[model samples]
Target: MSDRYAPDVQEERRAAIVAGLVTAAVGFTSSFAVVLAGLDAVGASASQAASGLLILCVTQGLGTILLALRYRVPVTLAWSTPGAALLATTGMVDGGWPAAVGAFLVVGLLVVATAAIKQLADLVRAIPTSIAQAMLAGVLVPLCLAPVTATAERPLLLAPVVLTWLLLAALAPRWASPAALVVALTLAVLAGDDRSGAVWPGLAWTMPTFSIGAVVGLAVPLYLVTMAAQNVPGAAVLTSFGYRPPWRAAMLVTGVGTIGGAPAGGHAINLAAISAALSASPEAGPDPSKRWVAAVTTGTTYVVIAPLAALLTAVVVAAPPGLVAAAAGLALLTTLAGSLRAALTAADRAEPAIVTFLVAASGISVWGIGAAFWALVAGVIAHLVLRRTVRAR
Candidate 1:
């Protein structure tokens, strides 16, 4: 009986390792371009962006490892992809890259506060789901359109990337964005300019400088998006797998990770939502008790790959103007669709949602604040006014 059981145990260990590697691969490859693009848009130099990516990977990986080991559960963490998309749309704020770093620090503090203060978490929860989703949908619209716009701009170069994405999406949906990115990266290399001096893992740090505009425009929206889109969904995913993650501990870990990585150029880090399933699900192993192994493997994989951030950043920097955007756009398509569906799901709240969506997509800024902050402002007001009118009626 012991000998017979040994084979099963070995198989489970193998499956756990495979699942972990796949989880890390899918998570990193799919949205890394979006992160790089976001950092660049917010004025991160190449080295700074690479440093940001590297630190994000290291911190989230370390956080996941610590959490999974401590709780004996499969827990995973990731950079806030939607928050990255928000940065891509927000562009450069009043104080530029240092200011953006400052905003990142503020977001980290806010996450810590949410964990510590019930009222703060409640306040985040109180933001109407429809409005939040709408704002996210609106922010995603422009970034998601990159592929379409790139097609017209450089038809020959972008055509293959889009085709690969569409084909893989239909057949192996999980690999779609990653495959598309691979194609784009290859094209970038073939069409490469002199990248002779590019560093293997170029790293840089920027001292954070805070301003009111960055705090309101970048930090506030980033915190909201990270919480609403990543942290909440991640908890739900883990719960669905019968794992009761230590919520406060996870928050504190991620918040501290975010704060530590901020000056190094990382935007934000949080619980992994989509990728969490890769490690926590039955796919990791038949026995739920053993799934934590997969999480450890996943975390280890991320740390191992973190060093490649500079190489990837160099490739993107050397690529054509629209190429990286096209890949990033492909990566975000599903997220955009989901956000849109959620935003408009309820008939009663459709009006406010729409208002939020339009304002965010409008790309407007007032008094140095970006559209995302104002979209929330517009949405809450619309929701309240409409509610009062209905009561009066």
Candidate 2:
């Protein structure tokens, strides 16, 4: 018989709801700008950018629902924030937004292909943990620094937001970032900015236009970063929490979602790393079996809020850019700290990890490719050199 009326089950379900809501809020407030900035970098119009955001939310939301239900685990899905950061740094490409959409399609194919090819999946799995963590930390540096810079430049706008975050973080850890986001939204309303007007965002489709430069520079690097920096770590996080989800099936579903969303301006969607823990962790419920409820609730929240993408875009676009940055930085602070800790935990790999972090944080690009790819390359070389030196000694 089902334990539907049991007191423990009821408490677990309630906790799951809270976890899901918190995760959804954090996922939306934290990195939404990176997505917008990335689309803008690739020459998307305001309407197009809104469409992309909506598409991403919808697809990832659906993926989260499907995966959690199919696997009976908290399989959270998210757009690749690091991939978006790479796009932001890569600047405009030839053939504009269409070219970017083409790249997105190719990335989807690559993800699907990786699932089908054991060698490719194994190669991604072979990337050193320290290097991957370092790359993630580096990509997050600028975003994490936003609150510090905002405090200096826009104290009046950012002070309350930071104060709220600090207070909540001390007393109610999980809700701290979301509370800060609430403060930001409240302040944005009080500012009386006309640009904050609400309008429902409509879909805008663009035909894909493939260029060799776009394919090599954007598609390949995007696929690599999403897999290395997001999916792999996401799976590891789940494993750490004792959920052995079907990895290949999850990748296949994400790939299909990515492909479906590409023409509507969505970039890559993958397994979520930071936010996955919010739903999958023990705090979501005492019963491991009931934790999937949190993932389902998160997916429902995303789908419900997808249509409000235009309103959110307006709010962010209207707010003092510094204020928005501050909110985002605050949301990512915990993630940044965790990644840094993971990257530096190994004594032997520490130096190479630092190399990776610095290169990625530098935001330098060469031959139209972003710093993320180069950071991995540099870290690998540093690791090999250091190992050889130790052997000689």
Candidate 3:
């Protein structure tokens, strides 16, 4: 009798399941857009890009699982959706995929090395949570805005999808999210976004290359952007959820994944921000105590989904852009809203957050890294100097 039944344990397990499923649904939309756009940056043929995205999703899902299991904490893993956005507009301006892959390896190594020393984590922690939250908001604000921009073109195809998402998001919170994804994709495909069912990309493997240009232009910026805009917030998210995972573990996994997938147009791997939050939220795990289980569940789902790299790639190619855009925007609203709320809360830090938000939104560039890094650097300096002057007074 003592060994047979455990109701409390079962309730905890049920909560974990809820967390994993919701996050996975949200991740599909957010992650896919970045993957699709990044492929365009790398000059990947449609098939190759799709496969790369699939590989990325699967890997991150797996990473979320393995880490959560090892730590018995809600240590979630996700692709750098913003990092992919950083790569999308300008990556093609570089040496195409080859140079981009070279840049990817360098950044991956940097993340790994960051884990090797405690200094980086200390530095990250030194920044106020308010500032970190601001950076995160800056990164994700685009997700909410992109859909509006998309509607400027394909309203007919996307309006229905968007409306459907809204209806579901409001009425049936549990099944609505994932169900919206499926319906939106179906509608998009019906609208002829599916470019025929010839769903196979020519697979290729690329070894890492060296690029002094990429080092300063791409790698360093990626490191800064990803660390500030993604990983730092990611760590904070975990902490907010009552778990303390080793930062090294997160960095090491990203570094490894980055290097391994660069040849395939896998640009960056970092702690997921929005999707991870959704997955690890109270919605995902009703019982806060079972959050780890939710993370583990996310990982298990990833493992199941990762291996059919080719098939997964094909599906992305077949999906319509309008559909992807609308769904992604709708799916990620809560994420964007939360990040914005956090950014504006710290009165003293408001100026810096505004600067960061502006720079990132401007999509300007310093070298090759895009606006995300500069926004962080700019905000941090502004925040520090302002604080210093105040203290001096």
Candidate 4:
């Protein structure tokens, strides 16, 4: 008999379905705008942006499904939200979209190589968690300020959305972000022009264009952020709950997925950090071994939702830019809070973490490299110097 019909398995199966649906809902509602904004920042056309979102959803969905089944673990995959935020802040490069695509491909290959090379993987793991969390917080600061900016600029339109989010967050935290999205959409339809009435997104392949600036500015940084902020933390989350997924295989799937989808505008896909906790924890099912079913269900939900990318892209493009930013900010508030808590938890790392957060939040760019990289470097140097001085004293 199927597991679903088995006497002892039915309850677990139902619990898994609930976990998976909730995870999928939270993941999609939280970061879709960041992806769109990132693509637009790099000069992708509306259809190209939609195609990227669709490709990302489909590839990550497939990767999650394959990895969960193969490993019998809750191997949830996600688009790199931090990477998207990085892209949004990085702005357009010399060769524009084509160059960005080239960077995406390079980042994917780097991830694959990182998995294959033991030392490289070890090096990634060696980066201080506090520094990484600080950098993430720094990168998120500007985006997180969007709600305030949106409220100032368009109070009538954005106020209700923010209020709804706050209300729901207090009452039903898991559903808060999704409800806020609904409020935003309803307001958009009522007040905004219907420019995207019949727009259907189509695939538009971009030829790769490589340059020193694009590689250093976009590719290297994208790879670093994806590994530092997403993959490493995601692994930790799973391990915390006692599921030991095959690390190399998980990286391989994400790397391959990223490379495959780059031509169609996808950036990086990695393991889910926050959302994974939802589907892999005890709340997912009483039996820990059955939690993989939640991940599989989440993956299936992503696949089913991939076709709606055109509609989402249309709505995003038509909506007020500030409103979209506000929604993204609202969605990420919890993540930001968690990152800050982690970054500041350790006393010795707190100063360097603050430095990193400030530099990244400043959004400075030098020699085409963004502030995220510089923030990480500065934070590490501070950490080392301060530690040595303390030892000498």
Candidate 5:
């Protein structure tokens, strides 16, 4: 039989398509609430948040398709989940939503600069992994507590969502968040929560305005977290799967995508870390070289579902208070646990990491700069001081 016609090859192709669809479905459903909350937290109106979500889906989807086909690698991309979480926690910054939009543009430029300027790349890389992870862990702490807090405030409304999440977490861990979201939306409908008028999709473009505080507080931290948490690990995952990722190209693509979507309220987009595994792993196909099909499928799936963003946003907007947060919170628990473990695992760096975590979790803002930036600053200082003391000893 010809190689193309082989039974095994056909099976692999089928597997790849299925894996891609699953990747898109899981990636979109799992953390989208976090994205909405982040945009809303930054002062985006309902239309703006929906626009942001739409642009995010469209840009990353197209970027993923382009990269995967060009490189013949399963190069998946995602909106920066950690960055969104940072926005949710950081709240409204110095110049409100316009400034936040400006910060998103800056982050995109920085990403492109990272690809083009070796010195800038080295500087970003020089930040200690422990400190970076600690900052992320710290930033995630409060958001991860949403389920507990929501339960306390609205037990009756959230109980079904929480129970659905718990049951699926045990039986089908990957579906837990998505399932919980469905339950929440269902409850919202049953309660007659209505926002049908806002379901039409359109760009809610905002003029970008720069400010010193937003650049430092929002852009800098967002860039670091997206790099440390998503882009870096995404490359590592592809490498582990035997494909040499085109790093420069990947950064340029995601960076440009980020910029293009910024005015529409999308925060940032980058290479996918967690969802990359769905299309890059052997589960996509036993033949390593053939997995790009899965990535193409993933991207296509994202594009197809991009129009639903407005509808989803309307449902979430009308959901019972704390319900969406509970779902988003549950989605992030695994990420939080992983970040905490990575942050504290090194005995030598424990103190600095702890310092970083505490500062971030404290949710402090000084001179209009948020805790994420300060956490990194404090962690680095602690690390330097401790190292010098040891050297003196």
Candidate 6:
């Protein structure tokens, strides 16, 4: 009876349900830009690409729900939107969907290995919270400027939505950051940009083709970027809320989810931050000790929704591209800034961080993998070499 009637317990249950759905929806919305890029990279027919994203999303959403449920740790899992962007420009450039899927699998394996090794999470944990916070801010900075960057050739497309995003974001962060996107999409619909209001992806699937290009360009870089950019921050989010999730369990879940999503075109799976923010609040569970159930509930919901993913993707595609870009870019500002700071600060490692930041910011491509992976590698190597002599001293 106490368990049933406890206000905090009840509140937490309520928050879990609400936040789970909101996270799934917002995460799907947030991921569209990279999905678009991935679709184009494979040179898929519009309908095929659209369907692929739907499948990818469903896999990601279902995987998130599963991991969340298994650990009951509020472990919000999401595919790497940034990973998709990398695939779009690099991996899929020379390859097709088959190769793209191959990349996904390889990367998923890497994530699993990281978990098995248990060293990756530990390394990230070693960083000071102040440094983590700074890194997050730095990563998110460019995302803030993305809207402005797209305006030159696409003002007609990006202007109104970007303006609306800026107004709402500066005025009311909580309401604006997530809901502004829904509102922007609605306005786009009223203006008739939603060409496929009712059309949805019919049952469709693609078999993967293994290729060095996809593996190096799409898979390897995607894995690295998602790990550094998304997973690290996700852990920080949990820690910030005073929960230290079991790294082995969480990484295994992330790895499993990534593998599951690979066949369907997913990029990577990592823990959540902003979305998980909902379940971690005091309202979700006053005890905080028993908050695992909330994540369980969330993961279960993702699985339930998986079958209908194509339908959901159809809905996501209805929004105008410009509006989608603006909303996603806005939503990610904080995150991008955070990554940037991590890459930049560190007086001893400033040079490497700068190199990493510049390369990532440059948006260049090498062998079909995006710059984020290279940036991280570059930074890591620089940091190691520079610190080696100091440590020896």
The lowest-lDDT stretch of 10 consecutive residues in candidate 3 is 85-94
**Cα lDDT computed for each candidate against the true fold:** 0.93, 0.85, 0.67, 0.87, 0.92, 0.61
Using TM-score as the measure, the top candidate is 1
TM value for model 3: 0.80
Residue by residue across 1-393, what tens digits does model 2's lDDT show? 466668777888999989998888888776787787678788887678889999999999999999898888998999988788778766677668899999999999989998899998888767777887788788788877888998998888789999999999999876788778778877876773766455458888999999876887788778877987789889989999999967998899999999999999999999998889999998899888989999999998998888887877777667766786677678777867877898999666589999999998998877766677788899989999999999999
lDDT of 6 at 267: 55
In model 2, what are the clashing residue pairs, if there are any?
none
Give per-residue CA lDDT, model 5, range 1-393, as digits (tens): 887668888999999999999999999999999999999998898889999999999999999999999999999999999999999999998999999999999999999999999998899998888889889988888888989999999899999999999999999998998899888888877774674455679888999999988999999999999999999999999999989999999999999999999999999999999889999999999999999999999999998998888888998888878888888999998888888888888656589989999999999999999999999999999999998999999
TM-score, candidate number 1 = 0.98
Best by lDDT: 1
TM per prediction: 0.98, 0.89, 0.80, 0.94, 0.97, 0.79
Off by over 4 Å in 4: 1-7, 195-198
Sort order, TM-score high to low: 1, 5, 4, 2, 3, 6
lDDT tens string, model 6, 135-165?
A: 2333344545656676665777666666766
lDDT of 5: 0.92
lDDT of 4 by residue, 150-260 (tens): 899899889899999999999998888888887887677667676656657566789889977788878877898899888988999999999886789988999999999
State residue 171's C-alpha deviation in candidate 2, in Å.
Answer: 2.0
Clashing pairs in 1: none
- What's each prediction's clash count? 0, 0, 2, 0, 0, 31
* TM-score quality measure for candidate 2: 0.89
RMSD of 5: 1.4
TM-score preference between candidates 2 and 3, better one: 2
lDDT of 2: 0.85
